[model samples]
Target: MKILHRQRHDQSSSMIFRKDYTLLIIYLSLSLVSGEFMTAGVVAVGSAISAGLLAGFNVINCMINECCTDRWVSTNYTDLKLTLDAKLYGQHLVIEPVVKHLKAHGKDNPSKALALSFHGWTGTGKNYVSRIVAEKMFAKGMKSKFVHLISATKEFPHKEMVPFYKDKLRDFIEARVKECPRSFFIFDEMDKMPPGIIDTLKPYLDFYENLGGVDYRKATFFFLSNTAGNDIAERTITTWTNNLDRETIKLKEMEEVIRLPALNNKSGLWHSELILKNLITAYVPFLPLERRHVKQCIKDGLVHKGYYKSEDEISDAKVQEIADELQYYPEGVLIFSTTGCKRIHEKIDLIMEEI
Candidate 1:
């Protein structure tokens, strides 16, 4: 996995017999030794049976805890998305590289356990990517039971659940992730999953550390959160480098990060240019599109009110004006309400006055 990390660390289970178990052993032994001959015999018989039951329960509990702890190290992650790939952030970007890489080496990847955490702004397609991974697993005839929706934001009791998350959440997630052969669990808006989930998952975003006995290895665990930073590279390249250290590879990773800028960057100019090239110059497996059609996208969809009604109707001067106007008052683009848009319009009037 290009994004998440895995290390060869000792996956050990501590078999601690609780004090209660010791107390039970003592009580049963005393009961067996201190009664009248016949009474003692019967008591001894019952005590032996009780001891066996207690041991069984203790063993079962120990097994459960250990299994949960090591889950992160045991799960197999195949055909998963992990990289600073541009398609994720750009509109009409090619999906072939991710799919091609997986197809080429999904089996060859040596790591038995893999985890993927995908985060972006609202409606930025994290869920869509998870679904695509699930479908790919299905195509390969892998038994992948991908859990598409995890409303951890509302359900997880972030405070009281800290120990629970640290002790067992990863195992629980990975268990559900691979109920079949290849499973995935997508946690959307995962930041709100109590602070514990964030702290625990930060490693997946940043680096590979050998935290002993951390479950969450199974299937591919995807954390979808809204992240804000000027550099999209932080999400992809620096993710691994940041956790490791101030190494030179960190710079190389920067290259990866730049390739996968936040999805928002892809929707505007550069994305339009790519789509135009595919339709016009490159002619790479897609129907050719007129430049007017591309211009029309900006005119109708981008402009708030005074957009050119037709694509060809807009001139270079008009497009440049719109770009400049939007960039000058960037906050106006996110204002969804009439109140916000009206304020932006007032700002536009001020700028026009200057012009």
Candidate 2:
């Protein structure tokens, strides 16, 4: 009788284990389905359900909790820093201080929002860096609802559209920031924006005594343009000629150089009091990428397109040839790539077509 009872007990334990395993599989399936539903914005409680499933009982629950709990969420902590240092070929001056400021603000010490203005020639990693910042800061990156990307030229190109654009922009900023103070507002092609258009943001940008309504201080803004492209090119060329490391150059060294060109130019709105008064934070300069940097861009482009063979398939000789064929600015000076990295995809396509 005792032996029979022990066998029954062992069988019962095995059945219970199997049932738990089955339940775990069901929960995982539900989690995946819920994620898809959440992405469609159809189910309001889908995300909560998914989170509960993740936090639910499973054999690997402890491990999952240890790994996923705020690990991938914290971008300003070390993820952004790591990505900037590792992936970006140049421009430490832009990376260091920006990352520092972002990390500081992300922490509990409530400070004013960061306002960064990227000035350089087209394709010098200005847009790339902004996308990177958005990616690391939020799970969905640029796709996040909180990330408001406004293409000035595309949305508000004509003079007649200025008033409508201004009203829309103001309403968007106030509503978005009211919803989430940590929102990222990226204004691309700022050089194309008409005068007085940016000034609409002045009141929100100004420091306020009352922290009660629409505190823009907690919102980050990125203004990208080719306003100071020439100045940046000149400075980079000078550095190269003088045998100095361009990467080691600091923001203080080039901010004045970039600021003057942008502010004095008829194209940009930097002369406005909002900018001249220093309401805008750092002016990040992206230096011109040299031959080697161009080669690196080619390699990255190839890898992005699934052509990962470095030794035989994507040869250095081919990359150098492509770089040589690209037109450089200052016509024959070879100082900087005229298009920067803007046309790299086209070049890559040409090479792949040959293959």
Candidate 3:
């Protein structure tokens, strides 16, 4: 009689376990079908809890172990010390988002996952911003790897400078995950990376966690692309995502897009007189300053003064002397010089004589 009773008890326990497992499967199926992400999450957590209790493991201990695992990733914290007060980057006050995101990622993953997509025309500071962001990440104790594709010909090199096709980026990520397990990765020339690269990185977008069948990614990624002052088309990017079928289904429009404006010529009109002066004052006699150089100086001076301030402290006579001494500055110092430079000296000389 005792043996029979024990056999019955064991049978009942097995039945209960089977029932619970069936219920978990049903819940997951329903959650997935209904597209209720939160509900699915709850079901998963509950199932995990029930399973842990059945396995004779301390539920609270397991949770603590996971938390500790996350914490043990990085003991070093980054210091946000971006003192560059520019229009784009506010003081450290606005750095909370970046800091919080990075901190959370550092705790959970081996690396930071950041995607900085710079869209603009040629010479629009897209690459510049990427470099600056990478530097700032480094400043904050993050070892960042930069893949600059600021050009169409050169894309981000995979390991060994080998061929890295965009469609194969996810495969590449999977391949290199072990090598760069804990480094901030950036993709320059983002505009050229095949949509596949973006697709492979979608899973790393939100936060570090296992999504669907894949384990959670532990890295930060940045995408730098030139779009000539407009955001990359959502349909186009989305189309790429669909084509690549990243584990994380990212809508094309959902891409974190940052549009950088082209360098505004706040130097006003580059008339012959101003152009000549710019050339003479900037480089002449001493050295002839190109239009590009003068533009930068003017912009810097404005930034320094917190407004438009020119470094033309030299007297008009000196400017003229510089212009006279350096033929390179003859046609410079113009307010707007888009026209021809043929006989620019004659034109500048005439203008100077008249003035």
Candidate 4:
């Protein structure tokens, strides 16, 4: 037998042990009966045949166990739609493709674990979308042990630490997938990640065999970043200024628009071929929220605060007033919310205090 690493196959030892025990039983039974009826040579040949059969059986059994174990939650498109629709608003373009890709991947003959990159301005629901996805994928949601949330700064703040971080990243992913192949790794703030670090993950993201003893195909990866936020925001503003329907925005369009900026951005991972290789399943762009979208956020905040009053009570006027209070860049043009929805709760609380 070819030996790769003893420690690596430690998890499969249980199945191997059972197979050996079964083969031994069959061999002993065959030897006992053939001893009297047949010659010693015949018995030995029979034992060899049984050993060969054991190898075949072991392969089948191992496959069965692998299939049964680490089965991810099979969520339907309708279920995902309901879960995301209730929480996310004004993201029809972002939501539709995401649900479609997820549904396709969750079913039989599933492709590589859905790798998605969320880009746009801060607080444009990138993180929120990830939370909803995690919640729907597992019973414990983000709290699930299989779900790993990594902040770039906390994990690898200094550039010098990239080498160590790369090893730890590979080990962490390998160990977790070994425990449960259906693992979700969310790497937040990819824009702040050091150069060349994202490249270390290329192998795991590629479509390949698990001959290395770790299969990442069933493992999902999400990278959240604001690297191409400016480009995204500019496109959204152009769409709005031109009175174009936002629903027409396609992933292809967004990908083409964001790719160059991300590649050029100093604080970006686009320089990594892994990103340009189209290993990422989707470049889901979270569009910059207009005043109306911000108002929707404020209304959601009110409902969360137990203020389920009429629309008049939480009037558009009041919502607009609070939105106007938010600081925006490019002084004259109100292109995007500087804080996005990050400070919506605080603004709502202040508005209530004044009332």
Top candidate by lDDT: 4
Question: Candidate 2 residues 1-355, lDDT tens each?
Answer: 0100111113465457557866775676566557455555544355555456555543344233212123333435578878888667667777887798777667643446677888888878888888899898766667666677888777677777677777877777777678676777888888888876787777766676234555667678888989888888888887777899886576788988878877877654657766787777778888887767777788888888776755347878878877877887566667577777878888878867754
How many steric overlaps are in each model, in order?
7, 1, 36, 0
Instruction: Provide the global lDDT of candidate 1 against the true structure.
Output: 0.39
Q: RMSDs, each prediction?
A: 17.7, 14.4, 23.3, 7.9
Write candidate 1's Cα lDDT for 203-295 as tens digits.
322222223433322334455544332343233234333554222333233333332432224211122322222211111011111122233
Give per-residue lDDT, candidate 3, residue 169: 47
RMSD of model 1 against the true structure: 17.7
Tell me the TM-score of each prediction against the true structure: 0.37, 0.75, 0.36, 0.75
RMSD of 3: 23.3
Compared with the true structure, model 1 gives a TM-score of 0.37
Alpha-carbon shift of residue 230 in model 2 (angstroms):
0.4
lDDT string, candidate 3, 1-355, tens digits:
0100111113465456556766765665565546455576776776676565555333333233221122323423453324223422211222333444455655644332444333433333334344544455443322222121223234433423323443444565554444344444545554443333344355545444454444435555544434332332332234333664222323232222321121122111112222222211110000112333334433343335333244454344433442342233123334221221222344344433533
Model 2: CA > 4 A from native: 1-75, 209-212, 309-313, 330-335
Q: How far is candidate 4 from the true structure (C-alpha RMSD, Å)?
A: 7.9
> lDDT for every model?
0.39, 0.71, 0.36, 0.74
Model 3 CA deviation exceeding 4 Å by range: 1-81, 86-113, 139-152, 156-168, 194-197, 206-208, 211-217, 228-355
